[model samples]
Target: MTGALFEVTFYLAAPFWALMIVAPRWRWTTRVIGSPWIALPPLLVYLTLAPGDFAELWTVVSRPDLEALRAFLSSADGAAMIWAHLIAFDLFIGRWMYLDARRRGVPHLALAPVLVLTILLSPIGLLAYLLVRAVTPEARRLHDREREDQPAQ
Candidate 1:
């Protein structure tokens, strides 16, 4: 039950991920991502897992204690909730990165691998995006504009 939803969570998001990564500039890809509903499936999974154990969920989140938190996450439902949460956030972040990259003229070839890293390990992937973003012409231009606007003695 929960396991199936757990697997389905990622499966549901895969198509959106594929479209954003594979056809970022395509009209349909932009159309699909434009709507906020791309996050609904994973959020639904989180809703399913969360209310099942509200007391534990509340405790795990509201009051931070290591031992209790560890026990809570060790449960199947806890794991599912976290998994769905991760999937939803990762998808949203990937979508943002994709659009931002497109706006900045970052090459699709450069972004494909970074998006994959985001799917697998979001923090590292975000760090990579930040590194790339620093070197992007858009960012450089923005920086130059800001520097020019500064007052000199």
Candidate 2:
């Protein structure tokens, strides 16, 4: 049952990823991503796994030691809990990236691959997106607002 729920957690998260990656331009995608509750399903998975062995989890987390964490996450339940945790956080990060990109007026074509890379490996994906953001200007209104603040230079 624990293992099954582990798989179900990712399945639940997949659609949000799809919405952000595939149908990113849709009005509904933006509306749907606006809700933080998109994280609820994986949080439920965490709730299920945590109640059963919270003491061990507490130790592993509080110590912040590599060996302790490795030992705890070695178990099926611990692994599932951590997986759920990752799924929830990754989705949240992805959602933020999506909304921020849209608000910044970053092009969809440029962001799609970055979102895919995030799903595969988040650190690299984030680095890539940061590079994109550094080079790409935000919405023109932002630049205009900045100009208003500057005394004629």
- Count the clashes in each prediction: 0, 0
lDDT of 2 at 104: 78
Could you say which candidate leads in lDDT?
1
Off by over 4 Å in 1: 142-153
Best by TM-score: 1
User: Candidate 1, residue 66: CA error in Å?
Assistant: 1.8
Clashes of 2: 0
Alpha-carbon TM-score of each model against the true structure:
0.89, 0.89
Instruction: State residue 84's C-alpha deviation in candidate 2, in Å.
Output: 0.5
**lDDT of each residue in 16-95, candidate 1, tens digit only:** 99998878879999999887789899999999888888899898889999999889889999989999999999988888
lDDT minimum window of 10 residues, candidate 2:
134-143
Window of ten residues with lowest summed lDDT in model 1: 137-146
Q: What is the lDDT of candidate 2?
A: 0.87
